[model samples]
Target chain A: MMGAPLLEVRNLESFYGPIMAIRGVSLSVEEGQIVTVLGANGAGKSTLLKTISGIMDPEKGSVSFDGAEIQGEEPHRIVSRGIVHVPEGREVFPLLSVDENLSLGAYTRKDRSAIERDREMVFEYFPILAERRHQEAGTLSGGQQQMLAIGRGLMLRPRIMLLDEPSLGLSPLLVQEIFAILGRLNREEGVTMMLVEQNARIALELAHVGYVMEIGRIVMNGDADRLMQSEDIKAFYLGQQEAGQRSEKRWKRKKTWR
Target chain B: MDGVQLLVSGLANGCVYGLIALGFVLIYKATEAVNFAQGDFMMLGAFVTLGLTNAEYLHLPFWIAAPLAILIMAFFGYLLDLLILRHLFGQSQTAVVILTIALGFVIRFVAGVIWGHEPQTLESPLAFGDVSLGGVVLGMADVAVIVVTVLLTWSLYQFFQRTKLGLAMQAASQNQMAAYFMGIPVKRVQGLIWGLSGATAAVAGILFASKGAIDPNAGLLGIKAFAAAVIGGFGSLPGALAGGLIVGVIEPFAARYLAAGYSQIAPYALLLAVLVFRPHGLFSQVRTKKV
Candidate 1:
């Protein structure tokens, strides 16, 4: 919260054809903080990210970043301005090699030496991508492709990273490891991030601030640890499963494969 | 003139089809929509060259004049992308396909109004003398057709692989939305791909005109280029050239043995046969979309 908030969404509303996905939504991200938007399926989390990134346009509200208004800017222009979105479903170019995918992420940059340096940093984060740099991404396992997807997003050296359900298809072990990396990246580099995820427990544990959405509106917002203690959250989200028992259920899910 | 002489000429004609087909392959790889007006692109190129040569405004040789006309053709391609084709982005496959078809008709009609339907001969670098190789005769013009095509294809290959812009084009063609997220100028990439396709078409037109017949509806033979694309797999560049060669080489043999009837359908027949077995194409990446 030093200079200014990194991103601010004020009264944002977006539509899909005739259906209103979100109505009168507002949020804010501090310059160097991890903000998590937690909600169940169809709660408009992905739509919010898409609208801010310019993949979709909102009929109302404003998306301002670092004091510059960027509501209607094209997605390509938005990326060059350093807001990188790692979309859901790991849409890596299936025919391209891992190295090529990473290089393409830096398409608008002119500093060749820095791009090379960043490439090494990305490989350090995801060693599997480095190991399979020459292999086509489509051939990689789902978890590996997900890593590559994140790695591709990192190539732009983005100031604010928007991730949608990063742990969706990952194993429990991998999920824990990925969240740890997100936490470390935020702490060490101060790269602001917005994570929209279904894993409420982990999202709440890692995020400094949390916002809960139901039926396309923020029903609750507070400190992550404090939100976890809210009776409504505990009753609606945590009531379905015991708190510590998620680990056991996750184990059972993993054991089926084993 | 003997059987060998006829074969050489036939192969040379086949090279022309391959050249135009490369344009088809180029645009298709970057945008899955077929520019039905592709043959028209070639026709436009040749027509431009003809107009330039007729005007003698630059007072340059064919070498200089040919490249200049191609540059103009590239501009037309860019304009086409900006004006009509760009709107088709992210649209349904069938809608884009039909849009291109309509655009092709517009280009054809414009060319007919400008350049009348009389055939004219271009200045051939080849002298009238023909060399007989083992009883096979090849005029220098015929050799020029094959040589020009090979050289053009080699240059295009280098353009696609070694250059940064070319690699970006490849990435954009594969998944444009992801490309946009990757910081690529997706709109510029689309415009440039159309420019490349137009330039390639122009070169093919000039080479064919050098051999014989420069007319307005000269785009008629552009149908063969479509066959080349289909035979080669619409998405594969090398496959298109190979498909062009296959169609080119087969027709003469078809004419010689199959009573001249099957010769015309050689490329289309080859396309149908390939589609029946390898629907993705001979060299295209095979993929399955989730239902």
Candidate 2:
């Protein structure tokens, strides 16, 4: 949509021990856009984010953030380059208080005044965290932990945030509220995001562009609204197709996409 | 001896064990590796100071030689991590523990080659005869030992609580991967913790050497310190001091109250009892990692 995408990937491959986890995967996120990768379990969505964030190395391919190649840099180096990854499990330090966890999020920054302002802004988004500022992170409820995770990521003032499964294990009401906040952040703060999720309906609703991943490769990509309307997606992912409503004898499944 | 005299002596010895156990906890906290070589590190520090202060050698005064020895040990700790422990990262925890045991042997052998096999006394300026308080008598060396232990422990507590670098070290020790994600230099922090542990071990060695005779086997005392760490809840500093006091007091009282031979096993018996009641140690809480 612009001169260049804010984040770009090409032919990425990664492995876990002896198993091939991600094979020749590629995707991109343009500035100010919310892109979502939707897939079932074992589809390598987390692997893709981990590779881009430099938590794991790719056997082949390049990852360029903004304009620089950062395929094999250390995770800390990647964060300083303005790409923050909120990992799948909401890994806030269990023993550390909420305040200390947020302070640690700004570990890489030297702009003290801006860090303070950002902390205030994070508290604005998650008022519960502010109320429990001195409480240990482990004691917070699941929804609160997810909020703390995002708030910690925000402390970095990242240009692009890679959030993995923000809606996982959350109640529908909580999921709706979290996605609404994410949408507001994108529209108001201009923060680009690449979200990975298995909850297809909510993910598609929040994303501008959606990619369907099966196994380790992208099988489908299009506007999120169009993908949501696709018959195959409606049948398989959205659970909208009932047995009597289908005209065909059996639904066809695509194996590959070019 | 009166009960008061026995208590003071027990506490003085406990302070020495506490100092050594603190070293064990420091290295273990940062790397999650139980360093069997910690006692050897203390022995090396004592040997270095002895070599420097010996009348035949440099003959440096205790004040100068002790600090110099600690500084060198600190450097040695950094190199030990850089040259050996750094490469062991991501390796099996059991393998690293065995390697540390090997490292202990290497240090002991090296010290034997350099300083001979005989035991010798370390001279201290404060070793002036015993000071008697009413009916109880206390050695000036014992008083010196207690004072140094309290001061060192307080300073280390302040360092961890007040400084950014120290907080980073604590954060790294708690969750290394999360700390790295937060942009902390985890590897460098591990190296610094090892250096700090080495410096603390050196202080323990100097204090032990000043109290009595020390030989190459002085490092064997590290095993007892390891027990102290476990009894105190391995990661907690104040627990280490408490564990040491418990162990130190138990041993001497065992000899006086129980059979003369019971003293040697008294500390271990207490360790076993604590383990039976609180397997995580007296001070540690059960931490369950989120899935």
Candidate 3:
């Protein structure tokens, strides 16, 4: 709150061919804070994360990481600068062994002993990964693959982690398990995170600040607790229906702020 | 004694085929683009070595020329990808196949212009030497071929299994997007793979030249090597070598025991039989890409 945020994106615009996927969106993640971006499908939450992580270049505006302009840099270079993007669908190398996948996360680092130690640390975080260290990652169940993906990200020792839908396709129980570790990572390691999720309830509970996006734009932003109490969020996201309010009419009702 | 002699010669010949097949598999594994011109790359490597060692040219020793030739071919492969193949990304696989096929024609024509069409022998320390073991005799050139192939395959296996860069290459080959996310320079790693393949092709060409004679058309032998890769399972490294050995050993036996023309058709017949029975290959490890 006192100085520049660890990662700041200002008036960013990105296009998929002729269509704009993220239009003039701006957000910031302060060092050591867990920020969550909640949005429905097609709201461009993943696009925003991809742009910031340098996987997709922004057509306009700037991304500054630790006060340095990093727009248009290669994704690998962005990772070396201490930002790691855990892409959606848990894109773990399916053919590689779990250990090989973890070692690759430290590809940018040259410290031999530290890399070995961090590999151990990742195993500690996801003990299941250690038991299946020699197994091909593709053979793991969806939940375990997600754990391996997060463990792979931690191997980078990243200052800021951009995680896209860590809970996607996961059962409610597995989601709780993963989010708990994420909260611990934020608190214990001070690893700043910008998580994009559709499950608003759990995301808000873990995040310090939350942003609500709709159709490539940030429609609302506030403290997580206050946003959790907002009537609109309760009505639409938290599945709380007002008395006599039809489910079909919910989409037709305009937000108070708009 | 005759059978032992035939087997040794067949194995040495097969080793060359295996090395060229390794080039094919390495490039295919990395980029998913089949370099039909891989044989042409071998041809170029031989010509380059010839230019450096032949009396009318640089006239350098074979020992010096071979390594220099390998380095030059590696650099050429790297540049070819950087300048041309890199631009073809996102294009259809068929387009790449056609382009490489055309590239093969270009390489052969250019090589013909430089080295001419006549068969030429490569001078080497192993040319006339022979080692006799019991009742059978082996040409030093043949022994050298088998030894180099074994050593090269072992080192390549160690590299992919143990080295960081090698692991990174494997990771990139599996999933480019994930590899990029891991801070791997995927494009650069791909270029390095091409360079490695080129170097491998040079070794094949040098060994082939050492055994007998090389003409511009000698590269057509890559077709046999391609058959070997398919038999081995295009995705498996050792399979390629094993496939090569099968093809190499079959040809001589077919010539001696069967008809004269049967030797030429033996490898393709085996290729057909493998395709019919085990379409994925003898040691297939290929998996459909995860969405």
DockQ, all models: 0.47, 0.59, 0.66
| Candidate 3 wrong stretches, greater than 4 Å | A244-252, A255-258, B288-291
Better lDDT candidate (2, 3): 3
**Residue A175 CA displacement from its true place in model 1, Å:** 2.3
Tens-digit per-residue lDDT, A1-258, candidate 3: 679899998999998778898889999999999999999998999989888888889999999999999999998899999899998988988888999999999999999899899999888888999999999999888889999999899899999999999999999999999999999888888889999999999999999999999888899999999999998998778978766645546777778757
**Candidate topping TM-score:** 3
Candidate 2, residues B1-291: lDDT per residue as tens digits? Answer: 588778877888888888888888888888988889999999999888988897867899988999999999988999899998899878999988999999999999999998888998877665678989886899888888889999999999999877778778878988787787788888988999989989988988888888888999999988888899899999887888788777878767787899877778889988999899998899874467554
| Candidate no. 1 TM-score | 0.91
lDDT of each: 0.82, 0.87, 0.90
lDDT of 3 at B138: 88
| Candidate that scores best on lDDT | 3
**Better candidate by DockQ, 2 or 3:** 3
The Cα RMSD in angstroms, rounded to one decimal, for candidate 1 relative to the true structure is 5.0
Give the share of true interchain contacts found in each model: 0.55, 0.52, 0.73
Cα-based lDDT at residue A5, candidate 2: 95
Candidate that scores best on DockQ: 3
TM-score of chain B of 1: 0.90
lDDT of 3 by residue, B1-291 (tens): 999989999999899899988898888888888999999899889889988998988999888999999999999999988998989988997888898899888988998898889999887666788999996898989999999999999999999989999999999888889999999989999999999999999988888888988888888999999999999999888999999998899888999998887878989999999999999889878665343
Candidate closer to the true structure by DockQ (higher is better), 1 or 2: 2
Give the residue spans of candidate 2 off by over 4 A. Answer: A242-258, B132-135
TM-score of chain B of 3: 0.97
Over 4 Å off, model 1: A238-258, B1-11, B54-59, B88-91, B126-135, B289-291
Candidate ranking under DockQ, highest first, comes to 3, 2, 1
